[model samples]
Target: MKTIIKYMLLCLLAVNTVTAQQNSQSINLSNAEVTPYEIELTQNKTTHILFPSSIEYVDLGSSEIIANKVEATSNVLRLKTVKEDISPTNFTVITNDGKYFSFNVSYKGQPIQLSYDLTKFEKQKSKKQSEVLFKDLGSISPSLVDLLMKAIIKKNKKELNIKSKTYGVEAWLKSIYIQDGKLYFHISISNKSNLPYEVDYISFKIKDRRTTKRTTIQEVSLKPIRSYITSQKINSHSKQDTVFMLDQFTLSDKQVLSIEVNEKTGVRSQVLKLRSSEILKLRRVELLKL
Candidate 1:
């Protein structure tokens, strides 16, 4: 009887092992295979690939092909062939948005296409899956941050009445959102007159809210890690919305946040102030809902 019991246990274990092996082969293993994009390069000409987000890491399968990020652009990768008609090799690229791309490289005297945009081909993960971050972005994924900004722009809800208007131009504070350990501010600029309103700059600063004017003012400037602006100039009778991402910060009761926008070569400067109470009224972003 003891021998029969042992034999039965062995049989069950064998069956389970066989099932697990089949499941892995049919599902996970098969899904792990990714098709590589095919491209050809030449010795003289260079190929440029534009990504939707910033490029983080790149790996060359062979030394025959050299890749570099284009100057003044974070997401553009320039590829060139080291030897004429070199053997077929491959390369890999990782974007800041947590997307992986593979390419099969070959040599061509004159490739059909020299420029490629991989924006639409990128696969966006769920909010939970998109928690990956880069060094510049801190704790939040840059791609996720961009998505949140798009959602806020789509909603287009004016959450606060903070704004500045002059010379038939206005800048409105639309909404404030917080996620991970960062803050997002949505702003809108409108040109209501017939002339275009060219923007010189927009700045955010924390200043002392003193009762009397002091000879030496205390102010701390805050810079956004990422900013999206539609246009530098607001066309007549049109509005442009922008979003800025900053590191999370808090202020004392005696300090206030100031946002200023200036016109290029013009005197249409506007300033909007927010107290600690107003800054604390930020809404937490729900990435799933977005």
Candidate 2:
């Protein structure tokens, strides 16, 4: 029985090895090349290929318009991009095999020599970390907050305080920490108000630049505090204070977080702002934890 079990286990292991090899072969490329912002790959066998979900291609020249075109087949992946209405820039393409391809652009119907180096591109790409932080909130100003509050109140479609909405709130991100590859945003909410109010939910309006669509990325609702006092004075004077903490929040490249508060009484809402250094600090902390 022991001998039979051993033989069966060996057979299973062999089968698993074969399966893994086959799976790897599906995406194997034969000859791969990378230019500064471009990549070309050829496959050894006819296998279905998928384009990369995200890619950043940089142009060396000063051009207002740049476009990228990608094509993938069973055995090849090709990417091409050109600057419009400007002289072409000299650039390099680096291949995965430690090889570089150099190409130059045409300027005024003249060929300009451009030297391409794969190592340089790799260095440039690696120097900049692709991470998002809370410092991004600083761009939210008083005027923008007013506009967003007006929009949200309009969405609610209620007859609320139009005159008492004299107060404004802002958020300053102090620090961001990352642990285990997850992001932790530390922010301080500044409220400029004479009357006390309860904030029900904090809504974040995230804009998708690629699609030009606005979507709410996060809606953090405050845990309601129960009270026995039911008098109007008690309700109106009740001050709500709390810090929000979120775990495992992930950010995509070029994504920004716009925070807004939804109040139960005394004006409708407030907006928060974050900064860039705070974001980088958070990313560094998170990376260290991981």
Candidate 3:
């Protein structure tokens, strides 16, 4: 009985040792050591890899291998080896903020590993994204309101002054201005009704008002350059000043231009109307550097 118990303990210890070895297959590079950043995966097998941040782009060796982007707290990369001859191939990954990484995908059925090279990934500035207004909203100058007022006064143009109040929020189209082939809308929003109101999104477009509810209306594309509402949320009884930039467009008598604002929560929304008369009365302003 004593001999049997000793043999069983030895067997259990061997199994545990194998399990630990299998789980610790990852290669780490924290100690400034130069090691190969490679992984050996079997053909037709899928492997998941976790990264330090969100990934934006990935380049596989070929289209045959499938690479999927997994959105998580941190970025996850899913890679599969479909073809047999695709072993020993190289791949690259680029994070949304421009962090770069490379790896070798093999079919030798080796264990999983990681490679971290401080010399290669020294943490550089992330590249700017294409979301123009959302990214630049926080950096909007405090003097923007004064500049807009000065421009309106200098031009001496009649203000559209189109305003609306809905769901405890009041919005006004102070004026319209054009600079460098771009149209700018100066807008003011006040939360006077004491209800918590926040701007979710703002959109500018031209539509045929005569169309029926089910009719399809043509939309005009306008990109935003600088906007205040796009950047922050307004609380109850507070005021917000903002501007929108878009391609230069001339409104026709048959079509109407509209700016729609939706609240972050609840059913509160507001629309500012602009017809040919108001759009045609736009003032020309000097282009200020952002």
Using all chains and alpha carbons, the TM-scores for the candidates as numbered come to: 0.77, 0.28, 0.46
For candidate 2, give the lDDT of residue 219: 32
Best by TM-score: 1
Q: Which model is ahead, 1 or 2, in terms of lDDT?
A: 1
Tens-place lDDT digits, model 2, residues 55-171: 223233434223233343221223223332354555433221213334454333222212223334435665321222222223333233223323322233211111122355433
Regions of model 2 farther than 4 Å from truth = 1-168, 209-242, 249-253, 266-268, 273-278, 283-290
- What CA RMSD would you report for each candidate? 4.8, 21.5, 20.6
Q: Is candidate 2 or candidate 3 better by lDDT?
A: 3
lDDT of 3 by residue, 28-55 (tens): 6576432335766555566777665456
> Of the pair 1 and 2, which is ahead by TM-score?
1
Reference-based TM-score, model 1: 0.77
| Positional deviation of residue 130's Cα in model 2 after best superposition, in angstroms | 40
Report model 3's TM-score to 2 decimal places.
0.46
**Which residue window of length 10 is worst by lDDT in model 1?**
123-132
- For residues 210-286, write the lDDT of model 1, one tens digit per residue: 85664577899999878877678888999999988888999899999999998899888789898888898788888
State the displacement of the C-alpha of residue 94, model 3, in Å, after optimal TM-score superposition: 16
Q: List runs of model 3 lying over 4 Å from the truth.
A: 1-158, 213-215, 229-231, 287-290
List the candidate 1 regions with Cα displacement exceeding 4 Å: 1-30, 72-74, 120-132, 135-143, 211-215, 287-289
User: Clashes in model 3: which pairs?
Assistant: none
